[model samples]
Target chain A: MTNRNNAVNNAQKSWLYRPENHKKLWWGFGLILAATVVVQLFVSVHGHFGFDGWFGFSAAFGFLSCALMVVFAKLLGYLLKRPDNYYDDDA
Target chain B: MLELIFPPAFILILGAFLIGPIRAPLRPLIVLGAPLLTLYTIWQMGDGIQLTAQFLNYEIQLIESSPLRRLFATIFAIMAFVGGLFAFRQAKWWELAAAQAYAAGAIGVSFAGDLITMFLFWELMAIFSTVVVWCGGTEGARKAGIRYAIMHLVGGVLLKIGIEGVMVHTGSIEIQPIPLTNIDGWLILIGVLINAAAPPLSAWLADAYPESSPSGSVFLSAFTTKTAVLALILLFPGQQILIWIGLYMIFYGIIYALLENDMRRILAYSIVNQVGFMVCGIGIGTEMAINGASAHAFAHIIYKALLLMSAGSVLYMTGRRKCSELGGLYHSMPLTALCGIIGALAISAFPFTSGFISKSMISQSAADQHLMMVWLLLLAASAGVFLHAGIKFPWFVFFQKDSGLRPKDPPWNMRAAMVLLAAACILLGIFPEWLYRLLPYPVDYVPYTASHLVTQLQLLLFSGLAFFALLPLMRRTLTISLDFDWVYRRLILSLMNRLICLLSCLNTALRNASNRVFSIIWTYIGRHHGPEGMLARTWPTGSVVTWVVVLLTVFLLFSIY
Candidate 1:
C-alpha cells in the first residue's frame, strides 16, 4: 500500500512540473540571429553607403556605451551603499 | 479619410463614455476593440497627408505626416493594440478605457504639428495616465498617482506659459525651430525635459511607474518619455545643455536601477537611462544623432515592452515582483524566462538585437562631432545598462536560488503578448531595412562591422566579467532606492511631520496661557463686582445712555477735527 502511494505522488508531481516548450522559442530566436548576421555581412562586403556605414558606427558606439555604463555603475555603487531596508516602512 | 481625422482619439473618448456603465462580461471586449479600431484608422492616414482642424483661435493639425511623426505614431498605435491585448484578460474595463485614451493622447502628441496641439495632448496624457495608475487597485497607487498628476500638471502649466510667451514675443505660432537663447524656447525645453524624466524631477518616473498595474506599466513605458523625446527633437534639437542633462539622466538611471528591488521599477529607471541616450543624441543633433534618437525610440518601445511583459507574466503567475522573493522561476516559467532573457540581451545591445542596431547612431554622431567626453560617457552608460537592467533583472528573477514555489505559466493571452513582442524585438534587430526606412533621415546606417563588433564584444564581455566579479555587491534586497522624489516623499514628509508636531505644541501652550490670563481677569472682576461692591452697582439705563452719548459726541468731535 505504501509503495503504491509513492508511485501516485511521483506521477502527480511529474504532471505539475511540466517544462515549457523551449524548442519553438529558441529556434525562432536562432533563425533571426543568423539572418541578422547574414545581412550585416552582406552589407559590409558590398560596402553599402550612408545608413549602412552609420549602422556599423551605431553598433560600435552602443557596445562601447554599454561597457562604460557597467564600469560607472560599479564605481557609483561603492559610494551609495545603504542598509538593506534603509527606505523600508520605518525608514 | 479627410472626414476621419483624429478618429482614433475620438473613438477612445467615445469608448470611455460608453464603457463607464458597462457590465463586467462585456467590458473586456469594448476595452480591447477601441484601440484596434483606432490603430486601423491611424494606418489608413498613411504618410505625407496633413490634416488640420480649427479649434477656437488656433489651427490644430490632427495629422502631421512627416516620417518622424508617422514613425512615432505608428509605434504608439501598435503599443495600444498590444497593451489592449495584454489587459484584456485581467484588467477592469475602466483601466482599459483610460489606457486607450492615454495611448491616443500620446499618438495625438506625435502627430501634433504645433505647440498648442502638443500641449493639449500632453495634458490629456498626464490626466489619463494618472487614472491608469490609480486603477492598479491599491492604496499605494492613489498617493503615487496624485504625485504623478501634480508633476505633469506643473509641467503642462510651464509649457503653456512658454508657448504663450513664444506667441507674444515672436508674434508667431509656426511651431518651427526657434533658437535656444530665447526665453520662450528655454522654458519650452524645460517643460519637455520634465516629461523626458530629466533629473531633479526625475524621481516621479521611478516613484510612480512601478506602482502601476503590471500591464499598465507596459503601456506607461512607451508613451510619456517618448513623446517628450519627440517634443525635444522638434523644439530644441541642437541645444548643448541637453547633452549634460542627458548624461545626468543616464548615470542617475544606472545608479537608482542598481539600488531598486522591484522588477518593474528597475525597468522604469532604465527608461530614463535609455531616453537619456536619445536625449544626448538629440542634443548632438547631427544627421546621425537624430537618426539614432529616432531609431532608438523606435526599437526601445519594443524591447522595453518585451521586458515589462515578461516581468508582468512573472508577477501574474507567482503574485511576486520583488527580486528578493523571485528565484528559480525559470524552471516552471521557462517561456517567460526565455523571453525575458532575450529582452535583457536586446536591451544590453547584444550583437544582433534591436538595441544594437538603434542606440549606436548617437554615439557615432558624438564621435563624428569629436565630442569625445560625451562619447565616452555614453559608452559607459551602455555598459551600465547591461549591469543594472539587462543582466541583473533576469539573473535575480529567473535563475537565482530557488524560492521553493512552482507557479504555472501565465494564461494564453499573456503568452501570446510576450511572443508577439519578442518576435518584434528579434525582427527589428534582424531586418534593419524595415525599421531603418521609417527614420526621419534616409536609410544610410548599418549596425555591424568587423572592428566595431570585436571592440563592442570585448567591452561588454569585460563588463559582464565585472558584474560577476562584483556579484557580492550586487545582491538583491527588498529595498527602495532614494531618488529626486525622495526629497518630497521622505525629506519633505519628515519635515512636514516635524512642523506639525511643533505647531501642535505651540497651539497647546498658547491655548493654556490665554485661558489662564482670562481666568485671572475674571477673578479680579468677580471680586470687585460682587453684589455689594461699587463695581456691581447698576446705575441703570440712564448711565448706559449717558456713556453712549459721550462716546458718540467724542467720535463726532474727532471726525470734525
Candidate 2:
C-alpha cells in the first residue's frame, strides 16, 4: 500500500513541486518586489492621506493589517468557534 | 411594430411558465433564449415611463427607464442567461423555472416605475427564491428556506407599510429619490437594509446561501442584494448613516469569513463585504460615488457569480464543501484552478482586474471628499479582502496540504459559463470605459496610473505574504463560527419555547380554577335542590300551593295600591 501510494504521488507531481523550481519562484517574487520599489523612483504617489505616501507604505500597511486581522480572527475564534455540529440539533 | 408594451421581466416569466410544459432536449433553448430576448427589450426601452395604468386611485407604472435602471436590468438578464446555462442539466427543471421567475422579479424591480409596482415584483422574488433554496432538497435546505422566507416576508411587510405611509403622507407614488427622515422613510430604509444583508440581520446570507445546491447558489448570489443596492442608490443616496452601517458590514464579513471553514460560506461572507463598498459609496452620495456604487454592483455581480461558480463546481465534483476536505485539485483540474484564481484576483481588486477599476472609485470618492478616516479604513478593508477571500479561498481549496481529492472540471456548460464571466472580469479591468459609460453619472476617474498599480500590487502581494506567514493561525478546524443568527436560530426559538411552556401552564391553571369554580357552584345548587332538601321534600307540593296563593294575594294587593 505504501509503495502504491508513493507511485501515485510521484506520478501526480507536477512542475510546481520540482526542487529547483522553488528557487525560481522565489526569484520571480523578488523581482516583482524590486520592480514595485523601483517604480516608486519615477512616479510620485499621490497619497490619499498622511502615511500612504511613505516609501513602501502600502506593503507595510497591507502586511501589518493582514497579520493583525489574522491574530484578531484567531482570538475571536476562541470565543465564537464551536464544533461544526453546534447547530446540528437546531438544523 | 411591437404593439404589446411588454415589460422585459415578463418575457422571462413567460419563459418560466412555458419551460415546465415543454418537452426535454429543447428545454435549454427556451432557458437560453428568454434572457436574450429580455435583454433586447431592455435595450429597446428609452428613458421614460413606458407603460402606466390606473390601479384604484393611483397610477401604477410598470416600466420605467433610466441609465441606472437599465444597467441593473441588463445585468439581471445576463445573470439569468449564465445561471440558466450553468444549471441546465444539473438542476431540476422546476428549479430553473423558479430561478427564471426570480430573475424576472429582479428585472421587474429594476424598471418598476412606482413603489406599488416594485413591491409586486419584490414579493415575487421572495417567494420564488425560497423555492430555489428548497430545491437544495436537504433537511437543512428546507429549514434554511423557511428562515429565508420568514425574514424576507417581514422585510416585505415593512416595505409595504412604508410605501402606504409614504403615499398617504406625500400623496405620491412615483419612484423618485428620497431621504430617510420620516417614519415611513426609515421603515423603507430598514426593509431595504435587510435585503442588503446589513448588520445584526446580516447572518441570513451566510446562513442560508451555503445550504443551497451547487447550481442553486450561483442563481442565489445575483439578484436580491444587488437589487437592494439599486434601491438604495435610487432612494437613500448620501444618507450618512449608511457609511457607518457599511463599515460594520465590511469588518463583520472579513472577521466571520476568516474564521469560516465551509468554502461557499466564505464566499457568501465576502458578498456582504463586496456590497459594503457599494453601500459606502451610496452614503457618500456624490455623483462620482453613485457612479462608483452602480458600476461596482455591475462588476460585483459578474465576479461574485464567477467565484460562487468555481466553488460550486468543486462541490459538484467532489460532493464535499468543507475546505478541510479539499486540496490538490490543481493537479487534475487545472481549468477550475485557473478560473478560481482569476475570480480570486478580481475579488481582491488586484491591479488590472474588475475589482481594481470599480472598488477604487469608492475609496477615491472617500478621499476626494476629504473623509480621511473613511478612506483609510476602506484601504485597510481592501487589503483585508485579499487576506480573507483572495488568498484564503484558492490557497486552501486548491493548493493547501493535499487531501488526495482529484475531482476534475465540471461539465462543458458550467465551464463555459465560468469562462465567460472570467473573461468579462478581465475585459472590464482592461477597459473600464465600457462600464463607465453605462454608469448613471459621467466618469472622470482613471484606474491604471503607475503609482496606483504599484501600490495595489504592493498591498495585495504583501497581504499574500502575510497569509503564508500566518498560515498556522488560519488552520481550518471542523468548527463553525457563531454569528448574529444565534439570536433567531437559538435565542428566539428557545424564548418562544419557554413562552409556550409558560402559556400552557397558565392555561392549565386557568382550566383547573374554572373547573373548580363550576363544580363548587354546581354542588351548592345540587345541595339546595337535592331530594333530602326542604324544597324537594314530600310536603313541598302542599307548601308550594299555599305559597303560590299567598304570592298571588300579595301581587293583587300591590297592583290595587
Candidate 3:
C-alpha cells in the first residue's frame, strides 16, 4: 500500500517535472493561440470583424474560464477532501 | 423465396436469451452473427420502405427506411459485430448478453418509425447499458452504473411523458420533424437533450462511461448519444438553441479532456465534444448541416470505437489509465500506437481523414448560413480537438517519458477490432462517395476542395502547435474537476447531509415534547390512583361507588340546569 502511494506521488510529480513533454504541450498551446489571433486578424482585415472578434474573444475567454475552474476545484478540494474511503463500506 | 423478415432488434433479443442455453464454444459465433444478421436485414430493407405493427394499442414501426436511419442502424450493427469480437475472450457471459441486448435496443431505436417504439427501445437501452456497466464487477462500476441508470431512467421518463403528450396533442406519433414551440415538443427536446449529454446532466456520461470494463467503454461510446443525435435530426432539426448547447459541449469536452488524468475519462469527455459537433450541425438545420450531423454520427462511431479500442488495449496490456503513469509505450506497442494515432487524426478532423469529410459539412453549413461567429468558434474548436485529443492522447500514452513499463500489444481479437475500424476510418475519408450515397440528402457537396482542405489543415495543425505551446497549462493532475454531475454528486450530497442534520434535530425536539406529555399523564395517574391518594386501594371499592354516585349526581344536576 505504501509503495502504491509512493508510485502515485512520483507519477504526479513527474508530470510537473518532465521538461521535454512540457515543452511539447506548451508549444501546442502557443500555436493554437497564435492561429486564433491570425484568423481573427485575417477576418478583421477582410472587414468581417464582429463575428471574428467575438470568436477570438470567446476562445481566449473559454481558456480563462477553464483555468478558473481548475483553481476553483483545487480550493474546493481543500475544504472537501477527506480520508479516501470516508464513505466506503468499511468506513 | 422467403420474404425478408425485417425484425429490427430481434436478433439481439434472441441472442440475449440464446446465449444462456447455448454452449460456450458457440456463444461468440452467435453473438457476432446476431449483429451481422441485423445489418443484413437492414440492408435488405432498401430506402423508402416503412414497416409498421401494433402493440398494446400503440403503433410500433419496425423499419423507417431512410438513408439517415439506415446509416445509423448500419453503424450500430457494425459496432455490435466489432464490439462482440473485442469482448469475445474475457468479457463474462452476462456482460456479452447484456451488450447484445443493448445493441438490439440501439438497432430498435434507429429503425423505429414511431416515437412509442423509440421510447421502448430507449428504456431497454438504459437497462442493458446499466447491466454492461455492472458487469465490470467492481464497486466503482456498480455505483457508477446505478448513477447512470438513474440519469437515463429520468431521461426515459421525460421522453415517455413527451411521447404521450405528442400523441395526445398532435394526434400522431409518426417520427418526423415537429415544431419546438409547444409544450410536448419542448418535453421531447429536453428528453433528447438529456441523452445527448446536454448541460447539467451531461456529466452522467463521462461519469458512467469510463467505469465500464475497457471493452464495454468501446461499445458504450458508440450507441446512446449518437442515437439521440439521430432522434434529434429526425425530430428537432434546425432548433437554434442546440447551437449554443453544442458549442458549450465542445469546449466543455476539450477543457475536461485537458484536465482529465484518466485516459478513458478523457476519451469519454471527448465523446461529448464530438457529439457537440453533431448537435451544432442539427442546430444549423440546413440540408447540408443535417447531412453533416448524420454523416458525422456514422463516421464518429467507427473512429471513436477505434480510439477506445486502442485505449482499451493499452489498459488491458498495462493496467494503467492515468496519463501521468503511462509513457514511452510506442516501442513495445507500436501497432496500438499507430492505430491510436489514426483514430486521433480521424477524430481531430485532420485533412483526408473521416472527420475531415464529415465535420467539414457542418462548418460549411454554418458558413453558408452566415452564422459567422458560430463558424469561427467552431473552427477554433476544430483546432482545440487536435490539440487535446489528437496530440494529448497519443503523446501521453504512447510517447511520453518512459515509465519503464514493457507491456506488449493487446490480444489478437482486440488488435483485429482496432485494425478493422482504422481501415474503415481511412476508407470513409478517402472514398466518401459510398457514405455520401447513404445520406438522406442527395449528394451535391464536395469534401475534397482545396480551400476546405487548406483551412482545416491550417486550423488543426495550428491547434496542435498551441497544445505544445501551452504545455504548462495542460499538465495532468491526480484529481477530478467539477462537471455538471456536481449538481447531483456533490451539491446534492451536501444538501442531503444538511437535510439529515436538520431532520435529526427536529426528531430530538419532537422526542422531548412527547416525553414531557407522557410524564404529565403518568403524574396524573399516579396522583389519582396510588395508595394514600384520593383513590387509594384500601378504600377503592367504596370510594369508586361514592365517585360513581357523585358523577351521576353531577351529570343529573347539569341536565336539570
Candidate 4:
C-alpha cells in the first residue's frame, strides 16, 4: 500500500489530519503532562535542593522558565533579527 | 628501534589525498577503510607514549595511548565510517576527501601526548574543515567558511603561543594540567574555548555549519567541537571558570536556537548548548564529572549527527531548510521524522535515551558538590533543552501546519546511516554501562533511579507544555538573531567604512587647504614679480630707483653697525 513517497496512504489516513483528533491529541498530551506531576505524589521524588522537593516544583519551574525564555528570545529577535537574506549582499 | 615514521595520522591523511587520485570505484573503499584502519592502530597500542619522533630539537610523542584517548579515537573512527556512508554517494569527491583528513586530524589530536602534536593536528582540522565548509559550494558557504577559518586560526594562534610559551618557560611540551598562574595557561584555555564554540565567538558554529551541504553538514556536525572537548578534558580539569563559561554557552545556544529559523542551525546552536554541559562537567573536575563529560561527548556526537542526518535528509529531498518554509514532512518522511524525534528526545535527556544517562552525571556531580545555584541553573537548562531542541525542532520541521510538501526519506545509504545512529542512541541509553566503562574515570552513579526519572520526566513534559502554550511566540520567522559575530560581520565593517569616509573627507580638506595657501602665496609673488607687477613693468623705473635708494640706505646702516 505504500508508494515510493511513503505518504500516498499516509497523507489523508494520518490521524493528524482529522479536526477532532487535534482535540484528542491535545487532551491526551495534557493528561500525560498533568500525570507526570501527579505521579510525583506517589513516586517519592527527591530533589537536590529542599525547595525542589515541594509538590509540582519542577512542573511550575519548567513551565515558567520556558515561558520566560520564549518571551526573552522574542524580545531579542526584535533587536537582532534580519531577513534571512541579510547577509546575501555582504557575502 | 621501531618508529611510527608514517605517524598514525598518516593513514587517513594519506587516504584523504589518495581519495582524490584513486580510481573512482576504489575511492569509496579508502574513504571507509582508512578510519577503520586507524581505529585498529589506536586499539593496538596501550597507555603511555607509543612512539616518539624528534622534531627539530624536541622529542614529541607521535602517538600516546590511554583509555581516555582510545575512547575518543574509537568514536571518531565510527563517526567517519558512518559519515562516509552518509556522504559518499551525494558529496563531491573533494569534500569526502577533505572530511576524511579532518577526521584524521581529530584522531591525531586524541592521541597527541604533547601540546606540539596537538597543535599540529588542531591546525590540520582547521584547514580541511574549512575546505569541507567550502564543499557546500554555495555563496553563503564561501563567506561563512571564511569566517569559520578566521575564527579557528585565531584560536590556533592563541594555542600555539601558549604551547611555545610553556615550552620556553617550563621546557615541557608535554600536554599536562596547566596552571592558570600566568597568561600562557589562560591563553591555552581561551584558545580551546574558542574552538569549543564558547560565547562571543559561538556564532561561527551556527553561521558556518548550516551553510554546508546536507551531507557536508552531517560530517561538519561531528569533529571540531568534540575534539575541543577532548582537549579541555586533557588540559584543563578543575578550573572553576569553565563552569560559568559553560553555563553562558548553554543559555546563549538555547536562546539563539529559539530565535533561529534554519533547520540545521537550530541543531548547530544546540551543539554549543550540549557542549556546555560537557564543559561544565570538566569544570566540576571530579572523577564523576569528568566521566560524565567524556561520556556525554561520546553520546552527543552520535545524536547530534542523527539530528543533522534527519535534517539533511529533509533538505536533500525537499531542497528547503527554513522551518518557516517546511512543515508536514512527517507525513512522507516517517523514518526521518522518527529518527529526528529520537535524536530530539535523546538530546533533551528524556528517560531511556543516551542524553538521559550521560547528561545526568554532570547535574549529579554539581549536586554532589552542593553547587546550589549552578545545579539549579543546570536543571532549568535541561528544561530549556527539551523546550527548544526536543519539541521545537521536530514540531516545526515535521508536524507544523502542512506545507503540503511530501518528500520521501532520503536515499538508502543516508537512511541506513540514520537508522544505525538512532539505534546507537537508544542502545547506549538502555545500556549506558558500556559507555560508562569507557570513561576516563569510574562511574558509580546510576542513571535510572526512580526519583531521578520522575523529576526529569516532569521537567521535560512541563517544558513541552510551555512550548505549545507559547506556540504563537515560537512560530518560525524568516530571520536570524545576531550574536557577537555581528560586531565583526556588520558593526566593525560599517564602522570601518565610516572611518574611511571620514578620513577621506579630511584628506580632501587638507589637500584643498594646502592648495589654497599655495595659490595665495603664488598670487602674492606673481603680483610683485610677474610681467605685470611693479618690478616687471616699464613704469617700474621710478619704483626701481626707490628700491635702489632703500637698498643703499639698508647697506649704509649695516656698514655702520
Candidate 5:
C-alpha cells in the first residue's frame, strides 16, 4: 500500500495536480469575479424591468437562480435517481 | 448543364452507399470528400425550387433553395464532414454509412419544397438514425434504438397524416407557414414537436442518445433535432402555442440535465434546451426571431457536436461515461479539456462564442416586443444553462475530485475535428457578419455592444461563481434520473404485462367452465343412449297397443270437429 501511494504521488506530479497549485486556481476564480465587478462599473446596463436595473442584479440573480436550481435538482434527484445499472436488468 | 444539376442531398445519399464497398484506408477520403463536394454543390445552386420530379399527379420538388434552406443544408454538410472526420477512425464503416444516410435525410428535408418530399426524407432520417443508435452494439443500444425508432416512426406517421389531410383540404402540397388552427396543422406541429424533443415525449432524446457509441453520439447530436427545428421554422412559425411549449422544453431540459449523471446524457438534455431557444425564437416569428432560430441552429450544430466529441473522447480513452467516476482528466488530456471548456463556454453564450451571437437575437426580440415575462425567464434560463450544462459538464468531468484516472487525448483526426469546430465557434462569435450574411433576413443587430457584453459577462461569470459555491450540493452520484420515458419503458410495459396475465387467466377459466358444461351434457346423453337404459329394456307390447287405440280415438274426434 505504501508503494502504491508512492506510485500515485509520482504520477500526480503534473502541474495541475500539484498540491500547492490549488491557490492559483482559486486566484483565477477571484480575478474573474473582480473583472465582472470592474466591467459593471464601466458599461451601462439596459434592464428590461425595474428589478433588473439594480446594481449587481445580474450577479445576484445568476447566483441565486443557480443555487436554487442546484438545490431543486438535488431534491429531484432523490425522487428520480436509480442505480446506474437500473436498466441493465431489463436489457 | 442546368438540367444536369442534382440535389446535394442525393450526393450524400449516394455517398452513404459508396462508403460500405470502399477499402478501409480509403474510407476516410470518401467520408471527408463527399461532404465537401456536397457543400460545393450546395453553394453552386441559386434560390427557388432547383430540382423537381413527377410522382403520379403531383410535381415533387426535390430540391428547393432559399437562404433558410441553404443555411440549414450548409451546417448539415459541415456537420457531416466534421462528424465523419471525428468518427472515421473510431466508428465501424457501417456506422459511418448510416450516419451519412442520416445526414442526407436532414439535407433532404432542408431542401424539400413539398410536404410529400419532406415526409419521405423525414422517415429516411428516422430509419437511418435508429441504425446509428444500434451501432452502439450494447443491449441498451438495441432497446433504446427500438424506442427511438418507435417514437420517430409515430412522429412520421402523424406528419404523413397531416400532409395527406392538408393536401385533401387545401389541394396543395407546397411548404408554407400555416397557423395551428386546423387539425392538419396541429398534427404537423405535434409531429415536428416530437422530433424537437418537446415536452412529454422529449425524454426519448436523453434516453437514447447517451446509449450510443462515443463517435456515434457525435453524429447523433447534429441531425435529428436540428432538422425538426427547421421543419418548425418552416411550418409553424408565429404559432402562440409554441411559445408556451418552447418555454416548457427549456426549463425541462435544464432541470433534467441538472439531475443527470451520465456525461453524454447531460449533453443530450441540453440539446433539448438549446433547441428550446430556437423553438421560442420561431414562436416569436419576427424577421429577427426567425433569423435567430436559423443562426442558432447553425451555431448549435457545431458546438454541440464539439461538446459531444469531447465527451466521446473521454469515453474512448477511459471506457467510463458516468461523471461520478471521472475527474482530473484535464491533467492528462489537455487538448480535450481545452476544447470541452470552449464548448461549455460557447453553450453558456460567453462574450465571444457562437452561442452569444445567435442566442441573444431571440432574447433581444423578446425585449423588443416588451415581453417582460418572457425576457426575464429567458434571462433566468440563460443563467440556468450555465448552471446545468456550462459548468456542470466540465467541472465534474475534468476538474472535480480526481478519480485518479489518467487518459490521454484522442487520435489526431478527432483532435483536429474538435479544434476545427472550436475555431469556428470563436470565429463566428467575433465576426458575426459572416454568419449574418447567410441568414434569411437582412442583418441589423450587433452582438458586441458595451451593455450587452457587460451584462452577459456578469450573468455567465456569476453563474460560474454559483456553480463553485454550490459545488458541494452538486456532487456526482452513481445514478440516473428518471424521465417520462419511464411511462412507456416501465409503467406502461408492466401494465401491458399484467393485462396479458389477466387475459390468459380468464382464458383458462372460461375453457374450464366450458369443459365442465360440455361433460355434463355428454353424461346426460350417455345415460339415455346406453343399452341397459329404460328404452333398451324391452318396451311392453300392451303399452304399444293401448297407445294405438288412443291414437285412433283422437283421430275420430278430430274428423268430427
Candidate 6:
C-alpha cells in the first residue's frame, strides 16, 4: 500500500506545484500587474470620462472594486450564508 | 397538398422525438446532425418573414429572417451541436432529448416574428429545461427543478399577460422596440428580465443549474438566458430602466460568485454578470450598442460553454465539485486546464480573445453617449468579472491547493467539444469581423486599440493581484450565499405553513364560539317553554285566585264610589 501510494505521489508534477517556485510566481504576477499600469504612461489612454485618464486608474479601480466586493461579501455572509446542504431537505 | 414552410426549430424538435426511440449507436446522427441541418436552413433563408399563421384572428409571423434573428439562431444551433457532442456519451437519453427540445425552443424564439410565437416557444424552453434539470436524477435536482419550473412558469405567465394586453389594446403583436410607456411594456420587460436571470429572480439560474449533472449544466448554461437577452434586444431595447437593472445583476453575480463554494455555481453566477453587459448594451439603444449585445451573446455562448465543459470535465472524472475539495488536477488533466484557462481569459476580455472584441463595443457605446456614471460602473463591473470569473474560477479549481485528485481529462468527445469552442473563442477574438459581419448593424468599432488593451489588461491583471493578495479572505467555506429565491425556497413555504396553522386555529375557535352561542339560546328557549315556568306553571293557580279576589274587592269599591 505504501508502494502504491508513493507511485501516486511520484507521478509527474509541474514546476508550478513545487514549493520553491511559489514566491517567484507571486513576484512575476506582481511585475506583470505593474507593467500593465506603467506601459499606459508611454501610450496615453484617452478617456471619454476625464478622471479615467488619470494614471493607473484601471489598476486602482480594479483592485479596489475587487477588495471592496470581497469585504462586502464577508459582511453579507453573516446574514445570508447557510450550510451547503441547506436546500437538501426541501426535496 | 400540404404546403408548409419548415422552420429550423422544427428540425431540432423532430430530432428530439427521435432521440428516445432510436438505437444507441444511431442516436449520434440525430444528436449531432439535427443542429447542423438547422444551421444550414437558418443560413439559407433570405432576409424576410418566411412564414405566417393565424393566431385566433390576427395573423402572426412564424418565421422572420433578419440578421439579428439569424445570428441568435445560428449560435443556438452551434451550441446544440457542441453540447450534444459533450453529452451524447454521458447524459441519459431523455436528458439529451430535453436539451435538444430546449435548443429548439431557443431557436424558435429567435425566428419568432411576433409576441405570440415568442411566448409559445418561451414556455417551451421553461418546460423542457425543467426536464433537463430533473434528469440530474438526484433528490436535490428534483427539488431544484421544481423551483426552477415555478420561477420560469411565473415569468412565462407574466410574459403572456403582457402579450395579451398589448394584443388587445395596441392591436399588434409585432416584436418591436417597446416604449416602457404602459403597464404592458413594463410587464414584458420584467418577464424577459426574469429569464435573463436579472436580479431577484436571477438566483434561480445559480440555484438550479449547479445541481444538474455535469453535461446537463453545459446545456443549461447556453439556452434559456441567452434567448431572454435576444428577446430583450428584440422587444425592449433602449428602455432606460434596464441600465440600472443590468448594473444590479452584474454586481449581484460577482458578490454571490465570490461567496460560492461549488465550481459550477460560480460559472452559473457569472452567466448573469455577462448577460448584464448585454442587457446594458441593449439599454444604451444605439446601433453600436445593439451590435455589441448581439455579438457578445454569440461570443458568450462559446466561451461560457467552454468554461462549463471544463468544470463539467472535472466533475465527470472525479465526482467532486466543490472548489475547496478540488486542486492539482492540472497534472493529469492538462488539456482541461488549458482549455479552461483559455475560456477564463476569453471571458475576462484579454486582448486577442473573443470577450475583448465583443464586450468593448458596449463600453464604447456608453462612452459615446457620455454617461459618465454608467461608464464607470461598467468599468468596475468589467474588473469584477475578471476577479470572479477570469481568475478565481480557473485558479481555485485547478491550482489553489493539492487536494490530491489526479483524474485524467474527460473522454475524447467532451475534450473535443472544449477544444472546438476554445478555438472558436480565440479565432473570434483575432478576426472579430467574422462575428461583426453577422451583427444587425454596420461595424465601425475596433477592439485592438492601444488605449483599450492597456487599460483592460491593467484592470484585469490588477484584479488578479487582488485575488491572490486577498486569497485568505476568499477562502471557500462549505456554505451558500442566499438570494431572492430564498423567498420561495425557504421564506414563502415556511410562511405558508404558518398561515395554514393560523387558519386552522381560527377555524376551531370560530366553531367553538358558534356552538356555545347556539346552546345558550337553546337553553333560554327551553326554560320559557317548560311546564314549571311562569307561562305554564302550577304555582300560578294560587296567585291567580288571590288576584281574582283582590280584583273583585276593587270592583265593588269602584262601583260604590
Can you rank all candidates by TM-score, best first? 4, 5, 6, 2, 3, 1
Candidate 1 residue B428 Cα shift, in angstroms, is: 1.1
Error of 6 at B164 (Å): 1.4
lDDT (tens digit, per residue) of candidate 5 on B1-561: 443377888898999999999888888888999899899899998899888899878999998899999999999999999999999988999999999999999999999999999999999999999999999999899999999999999999998899999999999999999667689988998898899999989999998999899989998899999999999999888887777788888888998898888999999999999999999989988899999999999999999999999999999999999998998889889999999999999999998999999999999888878888888888889999988889899988998877989899999999999999999989998999999999999978999988888778888888888888778887777888888888987899899999999999999999999999999997777677657665557778999899999999999999999
DockQ comparisons of all candidates to the true complex: 0.12, 0.69, 0.10, 0.67, 0.72, 0.75
Candidate 3 local lDDT, B1-561, one digit each (tens): 545765859878999889878999999888889889888888888666367787988767777788788889999999999999998887888888999999999989988889988898999999999999888788988888888999999999888898899999888988999887778888899899999998868988888888888899988998899999999999989989999999999978877777777889889999999999999999999999999999999999999999999999998898878898998888789899999999999998877789988998998899889888898778777767876688889999987677778899988998999999999989989998988988989867888864455445555655554555466666666666666666676678888889999999999999999999999998888788867457764755888899999999999999999
Error of 1 at A36 (Å): 19
Using lDDT as the yardstick, the better of models 2 and 4 is: 2
lDDT tens digits, residue span A3-75, model 3: 9997786675545445557778667767765665566544532213343334345455335443443454345
Off by over 4 Å in 5: A1-28, B1-4, B511-561
Could you arrange the candidates by DockQ from highest to lowest? Answer: 6, 5, 2, 4, 1, 3
lDDT of 4 by residue, B1-561 (tens): 433334557899999999999999898799888877877777677688888888888899988888999899999989999999999899989999999999999999998999988999999999999999999998889999999999999999999898888988999898889989998998898899999999778989999999999988877888999999999999999899999989999999899999999989999999999999999999999998999999999999999999999999999999999999998899899999999999999999989989999999999999999999999899999999998899899999999878889899999999999999999999999998989888887778989987888888888998998998899888788888878888998899999999999999999999999999999998999998978887866765789799999999999999999
Candidate 6 lDDT over residue span A1-91, tens digit each: 9988866665645678766788999888878887888898798898887888889988899999888888898889888999987876773
The candidate maximizing TM-score is 4
Measured against the true structure, the TM-scores of the candidates, in listed sequence, are: 0.81, 0.90, 0.84, 0.94, 0.92, 0.92
Question: TM-score of the candidate numbered 5?
Answer: 0.92
lDDT of each prediction vs. the true structure?
A: 0.80, 0.91, 0.83, 0.90, 0.90, 0.91
- Which candidate model has the greater lDDT, 1 or 6? 6
For model 6 the TM-score comes to 0.92
Model 2 stretches with alpha carbons more than 4 Å out? A1-12, A15-31, B1-4, B500-561
Rank ordering of all candidates by lDDT, starting from the highest: 2, 6, 4, 5, 3, 1
- Candidate 6 C-alpha lDDT tens digits along B296-360: 99999999999999999999999999999998777789999999999999998889999999999
- Better model by TM-score: candidate 3 vs candidate 5: 5
